[model samples]
Target: CNAFSEIHGLTPCYTLNGSVLKDASDTISLDLCSCDFNADGYRLPTEAEWEYAARKTISGMQSGLTASGQVDKYGKEDTSIPEEEVSWSASNAHGSHKVGTAGSPFTEDAPPVAGSGNPNGMGLFDMSGNVCEFVWDWSGRYIESEPGERASGPEAGSERVSRGGSWSEYTPFIYAGDRYSYDPNECYNYLGFRFVRTVK
Candidate 1:
């Protein structure tokens, strides 16, 4: 990502006020950051950034936090929109699908389902479920950051943090705050990424 951003230096690969991330296709997440906030190029989002953005996907309306102030019989809340409408999960997807395509596993040639993918409330797509996204944090216990400070993760670790569940996951795994970790050197179909650049 840094290399890509560096290659596009000054003329950023993304536009701050446009559909900056709309055109992103396949991404390769490299394990390289104590969560760099001072870099001059694009980078992976911090875990906090990833979670906050994913949570905004529901905009609190379909979040099952509706004003009926109701809770399910299981003592849990439910997401209103069908899982298939917002994500391709174990219930709806047999394998990884093209990003931004909802309802079924998508192909490059398949036209996108209107209103199915996302604009969330944030105009971001596939934030809930697609592939689990790599974030710039080494696997370690959470450490709170003081106001105005960034939470740099561990100095080093055997694994890296990943957020947002994938098509292979069940509904619970799709929760915005859900997270998992994996060996940085290992590979899996469900592991993927999203890139970001701090707006100048």
Candidate 2:
């Protein structure tokens, strides 16, 4: 949509409108098809991809890893650092800020400007907080077994899964491992998404 282009200078021809396909919205239409790496376009990330990136360990970006070999599940896994330092929650922000603005005593009701909050081990910002991101999976229970390479969720479901807590939610809901779901056609002010593409 124009939001991505206006904010990040990247644009996709598709939007949420149901103009591309019959009897389905844009998100649902795209969800019906498997991702093609040869195609030059944006797509949503799978649930596994989102969590791995959120929990990954990058040398120079973040240090949430412990001696026990446990990586940070949330962006603020290190107890030594205050939660306000890495996340925007009720403790600091009563509402969303810009995208990446950093400071103490956050009282604004706006999302932070991008890349302003704590970057995760993958050097990606706002992986734990900001706005909950929608993934390309249907809502379902987790299976303990490995899902093979590039695993996705069930083929059909009533609700789509969203990960990461939003700016309007509390701290408990904003963890990297936390998940929620909503109707595919529903839209909220606190809801947003990120785009992913595979290299050929």
Best by lDDT: 1
Q: Each model's TM-score, in the order given?
A: 0.71, 0.68
lDDT of 1: 0.60
Backbone clash count, each prediction separately: 0, 13
> Can you write out model 2's per-residue Cα lDDT over 1-200, one digit (the tens) per residue?
32343355443333324332323345656556444433345667778778777666643223223211123555333646554555555545555555554233343455445555555556665665556778878899864446455567776788888877766743336666778888778787666677775555
For each candidate, C-alpha RMSD in Å? Answer: 8.1, 6.0
* Model 1: worst 10 consecutive residues (lDDT sum): 64-73
Q: Which pairs of residues collide in candidate 1? A: none
Which 10 consecutive positions of candidate 2 have the poorest summed lDDT?
61-70
Off by over 4 Å in 1: 10-35, 57-78, 103-116, 169-172
> Which residues of candidate 2, in runs, are more than 4 Å off?
1-33, 59-77, 101-113, 143-148, 170-172
Q: How accurate locally, in lDDT, is each candidate? A: 0.60, 0.58
